[model samples]
Target: MTNRKIVSPSDMAFSYMGRIDFSKPDSPLFIYAGSMVSTKFTGTSVGMMIFPHLIYKVTWIGVIVDGIQYKFDLNHSDTPVYIPIIDGLDEGEHTVTIYKRTAGSHHYFNFCGLMIDENAEVRPENHEYDMNIEVYGDSVSSGEVVEAVNYCEHTDPAHISQFDNSWFAYSLQLARKLNARINCNAQGGISLINGAGYFDNYIGMETVYKQMGYEPHFELTEWDFSRYTPDYVIIALGQNDANPDPKRIYEKEYREKWKSVYKNMVLDLNEKYGGKARFIVITTVLMHEPTWDDALDEIVNELAMDNVKRFKFRRNGAATPGHPRIPEQTEMADELFGFITGWES
Candidate 1:
């Protein structure tokens, strides 16, 4: 047993996946698939400071230590809570990783810091990936309900926090296969137009792309495009926009809107990021609609952006209502890996 010590986010080998605000050292805001914390420590017990937001309602976190995963829930709250990670270990050296498993619509949280044993030597891992990729999508990208037994088994909130696993999402899985580091800027039910049906408000990807944090109350910070450059940018959107609801589907207008929004997004990304990345626009496998696929193809062609391309996944069975399970996600990742590598070749 050693004395306890406190470590700041800056001290850890922190890798932020999506949009995040690190302006404040004490309370760095993690939004969407915003941040992932990884560090090596020599201690018996580890704890973290989690500040919850009341607006978004829920925060689900996935903690991985020595390859085992544990889920933690930090629901709506005003004050900060200190939760213990694990205690009573051999206490030599251990690697721990913490990541956001919830969707982007959920409220953001401030990862205050970490407390560990005093005598333990904490160091950041030297893990590095061969390539850097950024994926933008909805529930699929967020791995929402990926762990459910079936499409109907885990539909409730309890099942959601228990089953959603971002680490196993197609994007991350593909990243692992290609030895690439990825940032998943995704939210569940988000679309190019009005957002998903579950939420009350309409929050499109275009509107929330630049937000510092998902919640409205969090101070907005202009994301620095140059912060981290990626070799590939994958855009997986439109399922929500093409919702099965008759009221949601406006064939003519939807097609035009999709084209316009997609074109603008591509152009904006190229301009801001200096056209260095290859953008891949994708359609949802869950709702294999030809019309939607055609719209995406047109966007790529009309823009004539040589760097932009398109790819669609083969429809695999869903795990939850509309999201792919781990097995299906694995298939998607395999497809993506081949596509990306083939493109590179």
Candidate 2:
């Protein structure tokens, strides 16, 4: 491993994996690499830290840690990438890369700079994939936009009052903090299960993830999970499930069925990855009623076990009238960040 080769479509490089090309006004919000080494090998537990580069104008940005992805606000005009050198990575050498779904163009840009603890005692560099982070839910997770003129376009609507890269929603904020490479399977108007039940011709969670681009690279499903099994899965669903009408279609039998559906989904994922990873099931930010929180809690508590530790049910407080605004999402992220890394607020 003497000859180190670095490739960049953009002329940017650095040493010690610390900071590089960060001086650019509108540079990629995150840059780094990750390893699957165990904490025993390195004295630190690995994680990613994000600094918004702009004076708080980076509306969107993300990073892939191990394999489980995380996102954060692109608000700050400038900030540096923070990849925690943790001790849970497997004993070996792994490559960690960061990704950005450019806010305006909606294009995916993948880059690398961060590296895991190389100073560890047992330097076993032979693992293919280290970790995987999967985000599942409705619109927000799917990279959806309710106000955009078309489905293909992504824009913060005019009605949005509080606009700050730092004020961006919580999902993106937490993603950056975790330094996780992510697959955002959320779509606006989506639900715990298939949103098709709500919107006659709406996109579904699994379908969206499946339909993601694979032009030069193979789809996520086609990729080998052996390189890395999804270590963290954050399911932020149930926003649309808060329909006031008990007679709504997704209600009635759907309520009872949702628990089973959600439980089975987690079980299936656990089964797929051999129960070696972790799952975090989240409730809505602000639903129609508080009872929905109670129901979601019941489902997660009843179903999650073993490697899958369920965090307490979370809900955002009040915000602007129309939708779940950025402020609300920030509050939600505050809670979620604490849960994921066990970090104090």
Candidate 3:
């Protein structure tokens, strides 16, 4: 089936479900990578930090994996987008096709790109281990809002490309400081399971942990991670699932289910890597709800056993409107870096 045109938020949420197969060598899937920022239109609402409409241009890009043309959400005025991959196609050749269109009014930022290895391995042979790092999580992990895209209204077009060779993004910035290559697979607004949480919500730690082994449904070639291993795997999920909606409140049973999901996800990772890899879990900084934060703290405490460690992050003052901004991202990276290099002394 031809890919449907996605216009609404709900449609964007489940758009990954519709795709063609591109795993065969002859067939390649297309995906929308990178991001375009939008300037504040006269009547539009102010965008979120990760999706600020003032400093960035309105851009659209994509790539194909396995035969499916996976698209990114460019009209991210409300929340972030999560592009799903197949069950196990991480060991092959893949190509990405981008449709970059930027307006003259705003500077832009690219959403985190899809990262992969030859076959799901962490570090590849002869590949620099210290030079490679894999980041997994939601928008915050991908460097959501670096500037206001709409500030350039009615101005000359900004000289911005999605891959403008910059690392203002906290994840990429952190990678750069370490002199490591970044495999940033963090999507915006992703949940623990495929479709288990609300949009713009905190995705649980378990969900991201399970993402490392996922295969794209339409891969043009095989890609595997077995050949590549990162010295560190940073996980910055769990803000999107903290909402107190009537249907998703954390009751006793719900809490148990959440704990189970978190436990199993970590266990699976340990089993896959045989406890050789280090896992870091981070709490939400933009999260304002007390109940939600408390519950997450408890869950993090539970997941803190064995080889997994928990990193407590406070809300950064640089939140634009409501969500965390670039300042928060920088702070978060600083926190993680301290944990990494013993710089606290």
Best by TM-score: 1
TM-scores of the models, in the order given: 0.89, 0.50, 0.53
Candidate rank order under lDDT: 1, 2, 3
258-329 per-residue lDDT for model 2 (tens digits): 677677777777777788777886654443454555666777678747555555535442232334444455
- lDDT per residue, candidate 1, 1-345, as tens digits? 146777777764554455667788677777766257778888788878788664544557778887888878787667878878888878688888777777655657778777788877777678877888888888788887778645532343445355777888888888889998777888777777645434336667776665555444555456777777889999987767755363434467856766787788888988877889999988655644466676787888898877998887765222334567787788889998999999999
Instruction: For candidate 1, give the lDDT.
Output: 0.73
Query: Each model's number of backbone clashes?
Result: 1, 68, 84
Error of 1 at 81 (Å): 1.6
lDDT-wise, the better of 1 and 3 is 1
Top-down TM-score ranking:
1, 3, 2
- Using lDDT, give the best candidate's number: 1
Score residue 66 of candidate 2 by CA lDDT.
56
Tens-digit per-residue lDDT, 151-213, candidate 3: 211221343334221134566667756766555655555555434444332334353343321
Question: What does candidate 2 score on TM?
Answer: 0.50
Clashing pairs in 1: 3-118
